[model samples]
Target: MIRRLTALAAAGVLGLSGASATASAAGGPPLFTDGHGLTVVSRPAWVDGNERTFVFTVRTAQVPAYSVMEGQVSGEHTIMVTLPEGYDRVATRYPVQYHLHGHPDRPNTVVNQRMFEETTVGVPLITVAPNGSGRGWYTNWRYPPAALGPQNWENFHLDQVIPFVDANLRTIARRDGRAVSGHSMGGFGAFHYAEHRPDLFAYVGSFSGGLDLLSQEQRAAVIASTQLPGSGTPTVPVESVFGPPIWPLDGGWNRESPAQHVGPLRGMGVAMYTGNGGDLTVDPLQAVVENRAWATNIVTRDHLVAAGIPHTFVDYGDGSGWAEGCTGKHAQPSCLIADMDHFVDLLMGTLTHP
Candidate 1:
């Protein structure tokens, strides 16, 4: 079942006011109760030939609560929602597919929408891509040491984003009608959410995901790269997300790592894709990172198999590439699109309409 944080628990963590607490207890819409607000920042505009896009700025109620404790200020976040062609003419509700982006990458709704539109063709679905606020890792923070500003991404996505999409659009609104997928860090988030909140999604896909966070060597490499002097915005400290790398035994790491939570994914439709980091089209540094991620994905896949969880494993290794001219390298647009196409096909074949 989708394990929702109880209103009481959520209110306590967010420090909701008396009135807000009551509203939460009364089970009001998740975002409406705590002054967590949603504003349409942009009008529904036509984009990428036939799709319609709407952008909403989400002011999180939970972040302010965290800020009060940490004495830091938090800001509103934005998400883009895309509707399929003929959406205005159709009276039918559609399945919702949430596509999550990697760290240092903002939501790419237009590219995702175009990919979906071109690949799926007649498949009607609403595509939602929410910003991960850089390096939140889509996990709830193990507070005090971790910055409270971005660490509450799990709440923002589950309690805020999902509810907002359901309220504003025509959606399937249930587990079978919903799917989640992402790339790199987002791939980890997709599996994390599926394992943690299995009741919220029937299918989950991860593309070039960092599935195993407990590896010491990989952790060290990630930390080194992220802390490079001239890196751009959203440069994150590894300690802020998962604490010290003495992970594996660390509760924080175990809680978020998909490899640690494979039991929950039993019976769920899971799809994972990883490139072998051998493509000449990608940067050599990125190729090395992709190979590391591929190793992590392999370990995660093995765990799932050991747990008897059946899944689709797309290993676009160094030699075996896609027929569509994409190879096994991290962050290849063509490879990601091809993986998404297969994911959508799986969703179409497996999910039953309510």
Candidate 2:
């Protein structure tokens, strides 16, 4: 039978015990009434006779209702949390891992928690995946006025999501307690965000990421619509993603290039974990020896090395990530499930230890 307990009721349970539960004893707090009438409820359900059921919800709306209304402001955002089985929150103040999903992966990627919870079960932590950036790159693009629709994902996260998580949850929102990580485009965004705002994050992780596009033909290809020769083939949808390419603008492309911001990152005292899936190949060019994306990565890495940035780089190939150039069969990797699990496991370890 599944058990459901309300905030006040759960608090009564804890108060009755008098002694902090196992989880609470370990720096993890129990889901109880926050004295201010706010309720944190944890539900335990049995599925298929295995201990896979761990879900929690915060009644933020019942608290103060800080407005999920967009437009550069912060306050109360409801977050759904999944707790580890046998969790005793009163014990420990666990570390938090902010997970960002790839395109169309928001909300869904929360399922990836199984891999993480499997390892850090006893530690008690928070994993948040807020809505709004399903297709947005989490960057503040100045081109096209509203490059990614009417929504301003970058501002929304910085202003709204972060605060909600910090205020409502028993979290150590400081740099040392928070870690940021993502895959693919999310990986790109994670690194970019850390570079721009290193103070918010203690650790950063990128999986199968496309590091940079400045030096490689990938940039040209991305801007192919803008730079098409003779104008025969229709331009690619580059404008859709980054508005019109601003090659002529002095700081336009540089703003989008993670490679350009390596210097600041090196001095930020931030921890970073990055890995590439050998399965992904770079976008192939007609005459180029390697794919454009791969080329761009090399340029980015060279820049990082030159700047002496310290970071962990992992290369795990199952043939589904951004490989530069490969015409052979199964050119891209497909071990998404396994690779993702491995990468997250590695990230947890890095953040916890480093």
Candidate 3:
């Protein structure tokens, strides 16, 4: 499916040639570096309703050093920061939540797109959005560098990005000050990062993550053969992103699968928050091939039946939109804002309580 999207994008590039290519080029303002030579960018403060949006450009030197991205070079990361409104410079400590974006396939999607503006605004917390490599899984691929090898996405977020944010910003820099969440692929990223770095985050949420990345056998079936539907097949990119000894690479997948890592997460007292597409658009064939993405919460709820991990799952079919049956139809921002209100209330209520 990624290859198909990339191909379509390539085809669009071939046809349009000039406009569409640069329209969403995902590249923005020149890369800025911190005092430590870490590439960083701070955006003009955006004062919104109850939050301020600040952006950051993360340093990418550590990714290639860790051999994570196969061919990822240093000094090539972009991140965005959004904080609660009326932010004060006097505040020496504040909570930070790193947010990741979904794929329309842009390098700096965290800043380029507005798909998740509603989620961060007015949340009373600082938000960070780091750019994931195009079509890169938010995972550290086990395979060594080769053709289309890996993107070192996990290390990019954990090692470079988070440290940079903590160092530059006046943040609490603790597990409690840290929260991670995202929409779609970003959602998966949130869970994966939280699961791996339990010592760093007390709260984790996923808004429609492509969590089914755990189904390696199924993906292999799709990648190894070209009989799949809805997209073109490219074994090279798939192999590179997921890593090899293909076919049954559940180990690499399990590293990021929230379901597989549920035991440790619950043990670590990591709060889990997850949601799915109520009436919104989601890829088909989700149930057959990749069920874990949506079902993780359900399984999580059941698995944590005895354990007391804070968890919330919401579906937006309550008929709250202005002019419609579907809440997502006309005023998505309004509808999503309402949803965010409810979710935020739930999150604050749980996390703040003893």
Task: Summarize candidate 3's per-residue lDDT along 1-354 as a digit string, tens digits.
Answer: 011011223222123221112221132321233643355434433334333443444445444332213333433455555545444422324467676664423333323224335553544455677766434457766553453333577876787667766655555566655677665566667777877778877777665455554454434532442222212112233445455434465455545556555554653333333323344444334322223344555555555565556566554432343223333232233433443445445444333211
TM-score of every prediction relative to native = 0.79, 0.60, 0.65
For 67-110, candidate 1 gives per-residue lDDT tens digits of 21121123545566666556555444567889888755567454
Q: What is the lDDT of residue 77 in candidate 2?
A: 26
RMSD of each: 9.2, 10.7, 13.1
The true-versus-predicted C-alpha distance at residue 72 of model 1, in Å, is 18
Off by over 4 Å in 1: 1-49, 64-74, 144-150, 221-237, 247-249, 279-282
Any idea what lDDT model 2 has?
0.45
194 in model 3: Cα distance from truth in Å?
1.2
Model 2: per-residue Cα lDDT over 1-354, one tens digit each: 112222323222223222222222133333333323334443222222333333333332221222122221222223334444443325333346665655434332334545344544444456665432334466654442222233345555655556555554455556655677665556666777777778877667665445575664445543542334322122224554455555564355567677667676664333322322222343322213223333444555677778888665544332324232322111122223343344445444433221
Least accurate 10 contiguous residues by lDDT in model 2: 63-72
Provide the clashing-pair count of each candidate structure.
0, 35, 8
Model 3 alpha-carbon miss at residue 29, Å: 14
Candidate 3 Cα outliers beyond 4 Å, as residue runs: 1-37, 41-51, 56-59, 63-75, 88-90, 105-123, 144-150, 212-236, 244-249, 267-292, 306-308, 317-339, 349-354
User: For residue 233, what is the lDDT in candidate 1?
Assistant: 37
